[model samples]
Target: MILLLSLSFKNTPQKIREYFAFGDEEKKRLLLALCNEEPIDEAAILVTCNRTEIYISTHIENTNTLISLILKNCEDIIGMDIEHVRDYILCYTKRGAVSHLYKVSAGLDSMLIGEDQILGQVKDTIEFARECNTAHLYLNTLFRDAVTQAKKIKTETLISKSGVSTATLALRVAKDELSGFEGKKLLIIGASGKIGNIVLKNALSYDFSHIYVTKRSHNIDMSPNVRDRISIIEYNDRYQYIKDADVIISATSGPHFTLTKEHIKDNWDTESKKIFVDLAVPCDIDERIGSLDGASYYNMDDMKKYAVENNEKKKLSIEKANEMVKEGVEKFLKWELFQENWKVFSDATKSLEKEIARIGEKKTLEHLFYKIRDNGSLEALQSLIDTLSN
Candidate 1:
């Protein structure tokens, strides 16, 4: 049986989702450990900012133990009780698990539907399992098929192209709000993240005079075109730069708020038209900061609102994507049937080989042994020669 348990952006709050999120090293360690223990024969973990899921293959009878093992592991991060964790977890078994992986790989299950990044993320999860020696034949084929189907969806449909991602919506709001985009000083609180990079790439076309990018080390790698308009600044100095910017995009993964109400001082000039785009899930900027005079704040919900506004155009493409998933699922089912058939075929082949060996042994051994009494140079009869006796 195949099983998947996930804490995702849908039907779960950010607070609960964080508990399930594992970094690369943590995921690898957990996968290795799970395979080492009982019940789980194979394991693959997918950990993204918006979701955390573990996919495994095991006997149906061991399902309860498998579920408990995962929940116990999650306790190390959130320190929450098993009953409480159960409320947030969504599980899928066998066919559902297989279908869920298909949706996730195609980005249909993403916070930003049809976002291109989740495909790479799915690839990473498979690769991580392989590196940990936890992925066996079932998972390897499952992931490979998922990737192939996702690519087909991307090429054959317009789902990704028709939708607006959170990163793109952030820029759209700024463009719509600002009078002139040229020479506007933009502050990106967490510029090294996936969404931040997308926002920056979109902002580049607007010709912002100076773009201030803040990361922990104030170090960033950029393409030649992206390098032209940005300056890397220390994260500590963000508050100082916050007051001097027209647009501040905050998308950090910090456990707490990176930009709080204190960051915007009471005496500070709030007359300047400043916009805050909080792409972080738990929210990098404090919600209360929106109360500051002339300041506008947009959280993930806000960004998603704008993204959904463009959903109508993607309706047709989304149907096409779903059709592709359905077709892919059929192929997967066929592959599963093939696996089952191979097992029976293999057993029969083994039995036939054994019978052939037994029949050959019964026919000619005793006479050969008696006749080869004092063999001098047995090279002449090499083709017929056999070690008849010890």
Candidate 2:
């Protein structure tokens, strides 16, 4: 059986974090241990801020053993009673697992519909499992196919156009608030990350004259085209640049607030009203920062509102994408079933051919003896036997 077990933030975000809070080395060690356990053929784990899922490929007879091993590993890592969280775990088998992965890759099961980062997260998790030698043939094929299908959907459908993503909505809000970003200084906190990088790309397409990016590290190198127009600053020096900027977009996965009320209180200049977009899930900017005298803030939930309102127009496209996903999953299942049956059919055919050869040999010997004993023509007897067999 192919099993997928997930504990998502939808029900227990805090608890999920506790299990994945360890460093990479520790996580790898734990994964190796889990893979070593009995009845676990293949094990791949995906741990993010919103979800923690384990995908396992094993025999149906070992289902109980696999589940118990997972529970034991979770208990060992979390050091707490996990029975309460078990109820929220979503489990899938075989075709259900395939369907769930397709839905997840297509963003249908995301917390925010049409979010684009989940696909990369899925790929990264799969790659990590491969690196650890914990992935089996089944999972490797399934994940590769899931990635291909996701790219196909993205290219063929309009589900990812316009307000298809929270990052795009954040950019739209920035443009709307700043009135086209012409000749403005945009301070982008956490610009080295995924959403931040996307926002920077969108901002560059606009009329912004100066783009300032800040992160925990100071190792960023500017491109030749925008070298003169762009500046890289350390995280600590963000306040120095943000005070003079006309717009600010913060998207960081840091545990705590990267932009606190105190930071905004001291650096915010009333002469220019700064538009801040927080695309981080936990949010980089504090909510109270919006209540400041001249500061405007938008969190992921707030950004999603704009996407939700505009998505109504693309209802048909979304429905079409859904249908495409359904058709794709059905085809995959049919092909998988055919593959399983083809082996059985081939084996049965070989067995039947061997039995027919044995019977034909016995009958040919009997016919030869009869022809020799009857002193008749061998050709006539062989022809008679051939006709009877036919």
Candidate 3:
């Protein structure tokens, strides 16, 4: 039996979803924990900013025990009551589990649907599961096929043509708060990071007077002109420039807060208001700093409202993408049925071979595989199924 437990933006509020969010390290631990449990034969963990899903295969036909255990144990992980968790979490079993994963990989389940990031995130999730040694045959096949479908969706449809990604939404939220960027000094921590690079690219259109970047090392891929526009600040001295910055974007990898109230020299007496953007999972900006006199803080969850406001609907493209997803799902279903039939096929083929070998004929299992597959049709398959039944 396969089961999936999902806590996502669709059912849960952003504030609530944030509590369920896990870092890569946390996800690894969760996968390990699940696999260690009784009857949970194999497991995989998928965690992104918008969703957290645990896919598990178990020998237990009844999932009530598993569900109860998860709710009781993961309360600390998600910071919610069992009843409340049940309200937000969607549980899928068997085929439903397979369909849910396909949609997620295809970006149909994303907060910003048709966005490109989820596919890569799915790939990373699979790789992480493999690294944890928790990715068994079931998950490996599911993830691989899901990726195949996602790529096909990208290739066959125009859903990603008008891309309005999370990075764009983050900048959009920032733009809404501050009317103009002219003469504004912007400080970007973790300038070499993924969201930081997007912020840097998007900020080019804004008429900021200067852009201050704090990175552990220089971004070597930057063009000469863009490089000229940015002043590289030492990672440790980032606090020194806080007084001079009108806008500070922190997307650093640091687990601890990069911008605390201590970094604020004056008590909101600055000429212009300070805008702090925290895009890190654990959050690079201290929440207490939002209490300062004249500062506004916006995290990824905070920007989701703005993300929806600017979201555009690609109806035709989405329909086409969904059509492809249906085909993908059918493909997976057929493949799963074939895998389930293989055990019977293997046993019968071996029996037939032994009878032939007793009469002085020898052939490898590889030969038997080729012989069956080369002429394998629905009729032949049904015959094999009949033989197994007999």
C-alpha TM-scores of all predictions: 0.80, 0.74, 0.80
Best by TM-score: 1
Stretches of candidate 1 exceeding 4 Å from the true structure: 61-64, 176-183, 207-209, 215-228, 254-256, 348-390
Local distance difference test values of all predictions, in order: 0.78, 0.73, 0.77
Q: Residue 284 deviation, candidate 1, in Å?
A: 2.8
**Weakest 10 consecutive residues of candidate 3 by summed lDDT:** 304-313
**Cα error of candidate 1 at position 232, Å:** 2.3
Candidates ranked by TM-score, best first?
Answer: 1, 3, 2
Question: In terms of TM-score, how similar is model 3 to the real structure?
Answer: 0.80
Candidate 3 lDDT, tens digit per residue, 1-390? 678999886777655666656777767777787788887877787877678888887878687888876656566555556575577888998778888898899888876777888898899988999999988887888899999989988788876666667766666666677877777888889879877887777787678888988877766246887766778888888887887888888876665888778766543445668888887766788877877767788877676566554335566777888778778777877787778689988998788778677653455555665677688997887777688699
Residue 10, model 2: Cα distance from true site in angstroms? 6.2
Could you give the C-alpha RMSD of every candidate to the true structure, in order shown?
11.6, 9.6, 6.1
Who is ahead in TM-score, 2 or 3?
Answer: 3
What 10-residue stretch in candidate 1 is worst by lDDT? Answer: 381-390
- Encode model 1's per-residue lDDT on 1-390: one tens digit a residue: 779998886777766666666666667778877886677789999977677899998855566787888777656544566577688789888788898999999888876678887898899899989988999888899999999999999898887885466677788888788866777889998788877877777777787888988876433666786676788888888888877788889887676888888757743566688888888766788888888888888776555456665666677888889889989988997788778699787986686567557776544455344454446346634534553232
